[model samples]
Target: MNVSFLRRNRLLAGLFTAVLATGIVAGTAAPASAGNSHHKKIDYVALGDSYAAGQGGGRYLDECLHTKAAYPRAVDKLPGVKLIADATCSGATSLDVLKHQIPRVKHKLQKAELVTLTVGANDIASQEIRETCGAPGAAAPATFDEQRCTTLVLKAIANVKERVLKALVKIDDIRDRVKILVTGYPRLFAAPADAFQARANAAVDGLNAALHQAVKKANMWGVRAYFVDVTRAFHGRLIGDRFPWLHAEGNDTWHPNKWGHLAYSVVVIWHVKRIF
Candidate 1:
């Protein structure tokens, strides 16, 4: 609650920063419990958008931009955690996960003990950010069209119920034993230097809010699903900062850089340890 106290604890400081920036979490901070609680290896299957695909980390293995530096790969490095499959791809939507990525896993999904999904922002929010702000090109946008951005963001939030939540239900419909850890996107900017940064950050907050609620709704349906909030993982090290973990240019623009993926991996592993 106090600066000196937070300064003494980096973890507390990080959560404090997340609260101020990302606003109220839709559910409890403790992720839903599932999986074998005993420390065990996971037969993991990674699915969803570019963030899940490791898009910005580095050289890609395919058109999907599935880089070796992806957070899932980092997690796979842990002892006994074998990567069953990573069907993540850039620009994938919730439906894309159900239609394409899921099928790629085949019977593996039933065998997999842990599945991680990061979707929905690409469904509508990011496009609105690009519209209200500016297309991510050489650098982060300096200006923002607040009125239009806000309008589009509102629609995107509403769309989340139908598009994002439904996808969760479908995934939940699959074998219930498989634990689904649905991760939320992080704020792309640190201090939010201008309208573009501020509004873009807000847009992600809206997306995450809807997503958090969606996961809660899934849990109420008796599904083994949980929300992994990584909103403050890049708290003070976001875009507009000297050492941003997100890409400022190239095809990976706005996607997490290698260091960013590492941070994501840490948040995920921490959550996994806390839950399991």
Candidate 2:
């Protein structure tokens, strides 16, 4: 072997060893957080519905509707993360979070450095129209019945807004230092040109708009809350993305799949890094 070649190999080996040693030392010496004693370890309290729970996504834990790739689980993989991922069963509306999740969270919030919430879809009243009115061969609402569907749409939006506002109020009791991230829903229906489809999508958008408004109101009250808009994030990929996260009629398709969860994780982490 050429003498210079042998010397080059030795130099490369030494460099690799040095890098490995540095990584180990850094891992051991450094706390996961950036020197904030209060955030030495990330204590996350996750709240919300199926998306937060990682529904329909791949790699669910125990194959229960909740998947391992859910945003909370993804965040858990980050260095120094300690997560209390308590997103409940699917179909949980904002009211459920306030009446149930908030009470259960009081204990965790005492020490939590992060709190993330994803909700509002279940609060929408259009669930019945989507379930009952849109079925195959279901009688089209008579010209007279169109008003009924419209009525349901408006009622659901109003109720969802009310629930979202109440949840915002309850959020104030959580810890001050904890960064609260409120997430809006992704569009389940792709953008459509048909008049009826357009109207239906509008109802869904209304619910999401309410969610955004609620988060803003909470922020005004001095909660460290921010909203992650995922409405257009999945545009054009709904059908092409084999694992559609939208709940199919009757199945728990309303929740997110693994891919959908991953997308949400990206948005959440993007904002979360800003403060923490």
Candidate 3:
């Protein structure tokens, strides 16, 4: 062999050997990738009723029982998500979630890393209240019998409170490794400037107050459960702002519109990011 050609061939072999040795050393000394080894895989599950299901958000996934607009889908976008089940149905109350959703999980809850629940709206007939309050001539009642409305709302609140507590207990049993999130209701009515509107607003405030109290009692597990307050975020805008995620008045009034879903996603993401 020509001496110069022989030297060049040896140099090429040396470079190849060095490359193979570097890879072997790396494989033995360190992990395959910093992301692969240290990254924690999370199983995220969403529960509760319509708000969590994204009833009118205009897009949905058939298999997971989810709407694309709901916060779970948004959360799945985060890194290291291994599984997500957005099985919350449109009319589910707190009990429905605890009894129905928990049994349907094919994936084990033992590995759950996060959970988000938006419930209690369906514990009573909120739509009926609105219809009665806004009846053609119900406004300015001669006697102002708030009892009829208050009783209906209170009953609903009480039922939801009990169910929520029960659900939280089940959650604790399945996976204390999970971070639980409980969200308050979004403003369903426009803030009012008069007596009738004020009464309606007070009713809504009462419902949210009940939700807060329920979460407080149930979140004592040290699982980092927290409530997201979205009531004030849409205080004045819910009525006519063409909210992206709020359904139009006649279109399933209680369900969220696309924009409303986006807003929900933002609030959840804001809090969820903190834990990581």
User: What TM-score would candidate 2 get against the native?
Assistant: 0.74
Task: Give the winner by TM-score.
Answer: 1
Cα lDDT tens digits for candidate 1, 45-104: 888888988888888899988888787876565444567888888888777876787777
For candidate 2, write residues 43-106 as lDDT tens digits.
7788887778777776556433677767776665454456865755566777788888888778
Of candidate 3, the 10-residue stretch with the lowest lDDT total is 29-38
In terms of lDDT, model 1 sits at 0.71
| TM-score of each model, in listed order | 0.77, 0.74, 0.73
Off by over 4 Å in 2: 1-40, 59-64, 125-127, 131-144, 191-196, 240-254
Candidate 2 C-alpha error for residue 146, in Å: 3.0
Q: How well is each residue in 1-276 modelled by candidate 3, as lDDT tens digits?
A: 558544643553454344323421243332334124236366688887778777677755663345777767766665444445766787777777878887676365666877888887766555665454453233444454567767776777787777777777677678865677888876655644565556655665776787777778876655456777887545444654433235545645656666566667666765665554
